[model samples]
Target: MMISHGFKSSKKDFSFGPWKVTTAKNHIMKSKDIERLTEDLNLRALPEMLFGDNILRIQHNDGFGIEFNAIDALKRINNSDDTLQVACAQQWQESRVVSEHTQEVVRPYDWTFTTDYRGTLIGEEMQMKVTETTERINLEKLRAREQIVFFDEVLLFEDELHDHGVSMISVKIRVMPTSFFTLLRFFLRVDGVLIRINDTRLYHESVPTSLFTDPNEIAQHLAFKLRLCEKLELPEQKQGAVNEDLK
Candidate 1:
């Protein structure tokens, strides 16, 4: 399915974006491996994609991090600013990897709806209501509805393993619109799980870096946004009532 994947601003910030690495040379390495190196170097991997040539990894220390990539200085002189282009490719590739991982993680479950309108007047009218997500996902039901799977609600999810402690599962869900006309009334789960309802305005909101940085945060942010969107997008009657109440 074609999606209007959003890119973090930066024509030059190519290290991470939407394209998946369809094919890569053997020299390519997994992001986790690079992250391991970052830890060994006592670095924190921030979003920045450093190095022009080769794969770029972000690194940092003291609670700060930056991006790093393979350095082939020669590639720089040979009309190949390998550092920049490689960073761009890595950025694009990593985005694809994360996007795919998120998709894989969220594909199995159905987004349960909620009935609670208290979250907001808008939500009361537009969103499905449910209490716990687990209550909503009927695996067998999902399998049966596979024909309309694309229209099924989508969620973005991620998990992280700490050096010491149990692994963490992060997740977020969005209501996907059935068509372009429904874009204003529905939302789609994003890689970050920052659900964007209505392609009009709220979709453009910038969330905290933490949401994109961690899957859990993404999930939490998504839930909060969903609640908020529900409150904001009131039906015609509710909107009129709210206006009358204000007057």
Candidate 2:
């Protein structure tokens, strides 16, 4: 999908299966912020592994980490196009139970989904498609289900401290083919605290009393947890120093 530089000011709400999700404020990451992260974390884009106009990647000292990229439908079939994709390495003591050393840590199984989204038939189909496409890229099958759901775009906010932990927050919008309604999914993860929140709310429709916790609130909580972790900040760079140097 084409990368959109504009920000949507209005808060949005929508549903995916049984869960309701609401859009929080757009988390904007300025070019300076990207530069700071790149310098502080020694990040590099894995262009050969994933394709996108914008990509930021970093790994933690314990081997768990994440990659954020501009969402693209063409790459979604392989589950490589999410705004933020996190991988918890098998060697990480906290993630050892779920890690599959034989397979790439970035695969679908590591993703934590909301109960409503995970239990639905559509959710199952989505997972199957990801697994199948990951194993064998089939453009045809991916496009066939274009009507069901298509990842459109996302905004990301992250805090990664090498020896401490990593916190990632994503606000992603998905399009549903059958209706004009767009689904807003808020995802948050804090490796140090072992906290994972994947909540969905609604948008473009009348607000309903949701039975689940508000996604925005969950995001705030995660942000708070992130703040409690040791901060990782690099000294201010000189005027023209190269920012692309990776350790």
Candidate 3:
């Protein structure tokens, strides 16, 4: 479960039960590639540490798969001028190079690069249908100290925002003898503004007995949800007051 890593492009592949998984890493895009990305994504600016070619993939023998990559995640960003905003986000961006973040009154896009991208689902047979289900991820099982057969972490993108704070999205996957778990997180910390975090978790057993009934048939038990957390960077004097209110 050794993963080869380097500053440039590197990829690792592993087979776990009926699933095939791979992680790819590459250098951030250069000026030429940046222009292409901006045009293709219709985004005025992107993260400084944008690993556009990095990717994580998991495929099942039954024609089902999921993938996480910088391109797909960035595409999910809001394109409109009137998207998620913050009080000082625009000003902070304007302080940087005018080419990167314009000084215009309103930016053309959400410079924050907030995204709702869960991993992409792919297959020729599975049709996505929305339905209600009571299933939830087993936190206890995930927390257990199981022997990890394979594990790897890859960064999709990251930005320092002129060193104002960190805004990054990274994906980590772990495969045990029993199941595989994947976590993708988008973390943002606008200095003196607020902290926002978004997470996507995927978990499935490598060998499910129920699927043995039909050798060629496979079903993915997925849990999808939008969970967000935000905390205002209030003054120290207000902290006690706010905490008292929760009482």
Candidate 4:
């Protein structure tokens, strides 16, 4: 169910024109979930806080929509042995040799958790022919103080990277009187090694005076389907992720 106005509930929801939006906020996954996910993902390790169940879902009346979730996001990380690693690659591997983590190092993977995922598309029509575009989201309109009607943020995953720095991904969304916006960000700081970021933005507006003017009609929608990656020289910095935490 989508709640466009009034008080926010345990879960966040809202609507825009023909679209219905919902989001879930959850704490780290339990050991059982972690074990299953690790085996399925074919990874040596996972983030300390992996909210594999949380997601940001937006759907249209016509069945076209998109979803952002941790499971799918993490799946995008390169598990191949040839994945490009960071500067402190050697240090990380050497450090692991001394720790119990060495047992899981069957192969090399992108420990950074870097992903090219934007969001998962739903419905047949929701997916149009893929094409390149230079269009960008309207930052000016998003900055408008239009009295946010709904807003929430949900974390996908986070890892302290052996206390080296931090790596995580979270999604935030807000709805205004005239439109709604969403941002999915992945941040990484490997300390003294590198700082990286990946972002995905989605925006849609209501235009009552548009060509097909309807009070509840959507005017324009700009989809950010590209993953932005930035790696910087970090001047710095888990285990089975101890069995604990449930929400």
Predicted model with the maximum TM-score: 3
lDDT of 2 by residue, 1-247 (tens): 1223455444444544434334334435455654454345333221111112333222223333233343321122223323334444323324222245544333332233212231111221222122222233233433454454434334443333223343333334444432223323334343644655555332222123452278863442232333354778999967875668678
Model 2 CA deviation exceeding 4 Å by range: 1-150, 180-192, 203-247
TM-score of 3: 0.74
- Estimate, for each residue in 131-173, the C-alpha lDDT of model 3 and write its tens digit: 5678787888788888998999999888776566777898999
Largest lDDT belongs to which candidate? 3
TM-score of 2: 0.24
Q: TM-scores of all models? A: 0.16, 0.24, 0.74, 0.71
For each candidate, the alpha-carbon lDDT, in order, equals 0.24, 0.34, 0.79, 0.73
User: Which 10 residues in a row give candidate 4 its minimum summed lDDT?
Assistant: 1-10
- Compose the digit string of candidate 1's lDDT tens values, residues 8-123: 22212211122111111122235676566445543323122222223211111222222112322111122212222222233333433325436432110112110111111112
Query: Which pairs of residues collide in model 4?
Result: 164-237, 191-236, 191-237, 192-234, 192-235, 192-236, 193-234, 194-234
Better of 1 and 2 by TM-score: 2
Question: Candidate 1 regions off by >4 Å?
Answer: 1-138, 148-162, 172-247
TM-score of 1: 0.16
User: For model 3, what is the alpha-carbon lDDT of residue 217?
Assistant: 43
Which consecutive 10 residues in model 1 have the weakest lDDT in total? 108-117
